[model samples]
Target: GIQVEQSPPDLILQEGANSTLRCNFSDSVNNLQWFHQNPWGQLINLFYIPSGTKQNGRLSATTVATERYSLLYISSSQTTDSGVYFCAVTPMDSNYQLIWGAGTKLIIKP
Candidate 1:
Protein backbone atom coordinates (compact mmCIF):
# COMPACT_ATOMS: atom_id res chain seq x y z
CA GLY A 1 0.00 0.00 0.00
CA ILE A 2 1.00 3.59 -0.60
CA GLN A 3 0.41 6.63 1.57
CA VAL A 4 0.18 10.20 0.27
CA GLU A 5 0.30 13.57 2.01
CA GLN A 6 0.13 17.15 0.76
CA SER A 7 1.74 20.20 2.27
CA PRO A 8 0.27 23.60 3.12
CA PRO A 9 -3.38 22.77 3.63
CA ASP A 10 -4.21 26.21 2.27
CA LEU A 11 -2.32 28.65 0.10
CA ILE A 12 -2.90 32.25 -0.98
CA LEU A 13 -1.08 33.77 -3.93
CA GLN A 14 -1.28 36.82 -6.12
CA GLU A 15 -2.48 36.47 -9.68
CA GLY A 16 1.02 36.50 -11.10
CA ALA A 17 2.76 34.73 -8.27
CA ASN A 18 4.45 31.36 -8.51
CA SER A 19 4.12 28.49 -6.07
CA THR A 20 5.29 24.92 -5.67
CA LEU A 21 3.01 22.27 -4.25
CA ARG A 22 4.43 19.07 -2.78
CA CYS A 23 3.25 15.52 -2.33
CA ASN A 24 5.07 12.89 -0.25
CA PHE A 25 4.45 9.20 -0.39
CA SER A 26 5.32 6.37 1.96
CA ASP A 27 6.08 3.67 -0.58
CA SER A 28 6.93 3.06 -4.19
CA VAL A 29 4.25 3.63 -6.76
CA ASN A 30 3.78 2.71 -10.37
CA ASN A 31 1.19 5.30 -11.31
CA LEU A 32 0.73 8.88 -10.18
CA GLN A 33 -1.75 11.55 -11.14
CA TRP A 34 -2.34 15.16 -10.21
CA PHE A 35 -5.80 16.61 -10.21
CA HIS A 36 -7.42 20.00 -9.75
CA GLN A 37 -10.86 20.29 -8.25
CA ASN A 38 -12.46 23.50 -9.42
CA PRO A 39 -14.74 25.71 -7.36
CA TRP A 40 -17.61 23.80 -8.92
CA GLY A 41 -16.12 20.49 -7.71
CA GLN A 42 -15.15 19.17 -11.10
CA LEU A 43 -11.95 17.16 -10.97
CA ILE A 44 -9.62 17.95 -13.84
CA ASN A 45 -6.57 15.83 -14.49
CA LEU A 46 -3.48 17.94 -14.42
CA PHE A 47 -0.82 15.32 -15.07
CA TYR A 48 -0.08 11.63 -15.01
CA ILE A 49 3.57 11.54 -14.02
CA PRO A 50 4.84 8.09 -13.21
CA SER A 51 8.37 9.28 -13.67
CA GLY A 52 10.35 12.18 -15.05
CA THR A 53 8.93 15.68 -15.52
CA LYS A 54 6.25 17.14 -17.72
CA GLN A 55 4.92 20.65 -18.26
CA ASN A 56 1.76 22.20 -19.64
CA GLY A 57 1.59 25.94 -19.98
CA ARG A 58 2.07 27.42 -16.53
CA LEU A 59 1.83 24.09 -14.78
CA SER A 60 4.46 21.37 -14.38
CA ALA A 61 4.94 18.17 -12.42
CA THR A 62 7.68 15.75 -11.47
CA THR A 63 7.58 12.35 -9.86
CA VAL A 64 10.39 10.30 -8.35
CA ALA A 65 9.40 6.76 -7.59
CA THR A 66 12.59 5.98 -5.74
CA GLU A 67 12.07 8.82 -3.30
CA ARG A 68 8.34 8.26 -3.27
CA TYR A 69 7.31 11.86 -3.77
CA SER A 70 6.12 14.29 -6.43
CA LEU A 71 5.72 18.01 -6.99
CA LEU A 72 3.38 20.32 -8.84
CA TYR A 73 4.71 23.71 -9.79
CA ILE A 74 2.52 26.56 -10.88
CA SER A 75 4.12 29.51 -12.58
CA SER A 76 2.38 32.85 -12.98
CA SER A 77 -0.62 31.85 -10.99
CA GLN A 78 -4.07 32.92 -12.16
CA THR A 79 -7.46 33.29 -10.52
CA THR A 80 -8.57 30.28 -12.48
CA ASP A 81 -5.85 28.22 -10.76
CA SER A 82 -7.63 28.66 -7.48
CA GLY A 83 -8.82 25.24 -6.50
CA VAL A 84 -7.99 22.07 -4.59
CA TYR A 85 -5.02 20.19 -5.94
CA PHE A 86 -4.85 16.49 -5.22
CA CYS A 87 -2.14 13.90 -5.70
CA ALA A 88 -3.08 10.29 -6.13
CA VAL A 89 -1.00 7.14 -6.46
CA THR A 90 -1.47 3.49 -7.25
CA PRO A 91 0.66 0.69 -5.93
CA MET A 92 2.79 -1.39 -8.27
CA ASP A 93 0.56 -4.45 -8.10
CA SER A 94 -2.76 -2.93 -7.19
CA ASN A 95 -5.83 -2.49 -9.34
CA TYR A 96 -5.21 1.22 -9.85
CA GLN A 97 -7.30 2.36 -6.94
CA LEU A 98 -5.87 5.79 -6.33
CA ILE A 99 -4.89 6.66 -2.82
CA TRP A 100 -5.48 10.43 -2.55
CA GLY A 101 -4.10 13.08 -0.29
CA ALA A 102 -6.33 15.47 1.60
CA GLY A 103 -5.45 18.15 -0.97
CA THR A 104 -3.94 21.64 -1.08
CA LYS A 105 -6.46 24.40 -1.59
CA LEU A 106 -4.94 27.26 -3.56
CA ILE A 107 -6.35 30.75 -3.90
CA ILE A 108 -4.99 33.18 -6.44
CA LYS A 109 -6.21 36.67 -5.65
CA PRO A 110 -6.75 38.93 -8.57
Candidate 2:
Protein backbone atom coordinates (compact mmCIF):
# COMPACT_ATOMS: atom_id res chain seq x y z
CA GLY A 1 0.00 0.00 0.00
CA ILE A 2 1.13 3.55 -0.76
CA GLN A 3 0.18 7.08 0.16
CA VAL A 4 -0.75 9.90 -2.21
CA GLU A 5 0.40 13.51 -2.06
CA GLN A 6 -0.70 16.54 -4.07
CA SER A 7 1.48 19.58 -4.46
CA PRO A 8 1.02 23.37 -4.41
CA PRO A 9 -1.48 22.79 -1.58
CA ASP A 10 -3.37 25.78 -2.96
CA LEU A 11 -3.50 27.66 -6.25
CA ILE A 12 -5.04 30.85 -7.58
CA LEU A 13 -5.42 31.61 -11.26
CA GLN A 14 -7.14 34.08 -13.53
CA GLU A 15 -9.68 33.03 -16.10
CA GLY A 16 -8.12 31.71 -19.31
CA ALA A 17 -4.85 30.96 -17.60
CA ASN A 18 -3.15 27.58 -17.62
CA SER A 19 -1.85 25.57 -14.70
CA THR A 20 -0.37 22.25 -13.83
CA LEU A 21 -1.05 20.20 -10.71
CA ARG A 22 1.11 17.40 -9.47
CA CYS A 23 0.59 14.19 -7.52
CA ASN A 24 3.28 11.99 -6.09
CA PHE A 25 2.83 8.47 -4.79
CA SER A 26 5.00 6.71 -2.31
CA ASP A 27 5.24 3.59 -4.46
CA SER A 28 4.25 2.03 -7.75
CA VAL A 29 0.57 1.98 -8.58
CA ASN A 30 -1.43 -0.43 -10.70
CA ASN A 31 -4.53 1.74 -10.84
CA LEU A 32 -4.68 5.53 -10.87
CA GLN A 33 -7.39 8.12 -11.44
CA TRP A 34 -7.80 11.88 -11.24
CA PHE A 35 -10.87 13.72 -10.08
CA HIS A 36 -12.11 17.27 -9.79
CA GLN A 37 -14.28 18.17 -6.82
CA ASN A 38 -16.44 21.15 -7.71
CA PRO A 39 -17.53 23.93 -5.38
CA TRP A 40 -20.65 21.95 -4.47
CA GLY A 41 -18.59 18.87 -3.68
CA GLN A 42 -19.35 16.98 -6.86
CA LEU A 43 -16.66 14.55 -7.95
CA ILE A 44 -15.88 14.66 -11.67
CA ASN A 45 -13.44 12.09 -12.97
CA LEU A 46 -10.96 13.65 -15.38
CA PHE A 47 -8.82 10.67 -16.17
CA TYR A 48 -8.25 6.98 -15.53
CA ILE A 49 -4.72 7.03 -16.89
CA PRO A 50 -2.64 4.41 -15.14
CA SER A 51 0.52 4.89 -17.14
CA GLY A 52 -0.11 7.21 -20.05
CA THR A 53 -1.35 10.60 -21.14
CA LYS A 54 -4.86 11.60 -22.21
CA GLN A 55 -6.60 14.86 -22.98
CA ASN A 56 -10.23 15.87 -22.62
CA GLY A 57 -11.46 19.31 -23.44
CA ARG A 58 -9.60 21.76 -21.24
CA LEU A 59 -7.98 19.08 -19.14
CA SER A 60 -5.22 16.54 -19.62
CA ALA A 61 -3.24 14.16 -17.42
CA THR A 62 -0.09 12.07 -17.44
CA THR A 63 1.00 9.28 -15.15
CA VAL A 64 4.52 7.97 -14.86
CA ALA A 65 4.39 4.56 -13.22
CA THR A 66 8.13 4.30 -13.01
CA GLU A 67 8.54 7.68 -11.36
CA ARG A 68 5.48 7.06 -9.23
CA TYR A 69 3.91 10.41 -10.02
CA SER A 70 1.20 12.07 -12.08
CA LEU A 71 0.47 15.50 -13.48
CA LEU A 72 -2.84 17.17 -14.30
CA TYR A 73 -2.95 20.11 -16.68
CA ILE A 74 -5.73 22.61 -16.99
CA SER A 75 -5.93 24.88 -20.00
CA SER A 76 -7.97 28.07 -20.26
CA SER A 77 -9.07 27.85 -16.68
CA GLN A 78 -12.47 29.19 -15.80
CA THR A 79 -14.25 30.54 -12.74
CA THR A 80 -16.28 27.36 -12.52
CA ASP A 81 -13.04 25.45 -12.33
CA SER A 82 -12.45 26.72 -8.85
CA GLY A 83 -12.36 23.71 -6.60
CA VAL A 84 -10.16 20.89 -5.41
CA TYR A 85 -8.30 18.48 -7.65
CA PHE A 86 -7.59 15.03 -6.28
CA CYS A 87 -5.63 11.98 -7.28
CA ALA A 88 -6.73 8.52 -6.19
CA VAL A 89 -4.90 5.26 -6.65
CA THR A 90 -4.73 1.57 -5.70
CA PRO A 91 -1.46 -0.20 -5.17
CA MET A 92 -0.59 -3.55 -6.69
CA ASP A 93 -2.31 -6.60 -5.15
CA SER A 94 -3.90 -6.61 -1.69
CA ASN A 95 -7.32 -5.14 -1.10
CA TYR A 96 -9.06 -3.00 -3.69
CA GLN A 97 -9.05 0.10 -1.59
CA LEU A 98 -8.20 3.51 -3.00
CA ILE A 99 -5.93 5.98 -1.25
CA TRP A 100 -6.78 9.62 -1.89
CA GLY A 101 -4.71 12.74 -1.56
CA ALA A 102 -5.65 15.83 0.45
CA GLY A 103 -6.27 17.57 -2.87
CA THR A 104 -4.99 20.76 -4.47
CA LYS A 105 -7.31 23.65 -3.85
CA LEU A 106 -7.71 25.76 -6.97
CA ILE A 107 -9.37 29.15 -7.13
CA ILE A 108 -9.99 30.84 -10.44
CA LYS A 109 -10.46 34.54 -10.02
CA PRO A 110 -12.62 36.55 -12.34
The models' CA-based lDDT, in order, is 0.94, 0.93
> lDDT by residue for model 1 over 1-110, one digit each (tens)?
57799998999999999999999999888799999999999999999999999999999999987888899999999999999999999987888488999999999999
> What is the model-wide C-alpha lDDT for candidate 2?
0.93
- Say which candidate scores most in TM-score: 1
Score every model by TM-score.
0.97, 0.96
Q: lDDT score, residue 57, model 2?
A: 92
Clashes of each: 0, 0
Per-residue lDDT tens digits for candidate 2, residues 4-104, read 99998999999999999999999877889999999998999889999989999999999999999999999999999999999999888746788999999
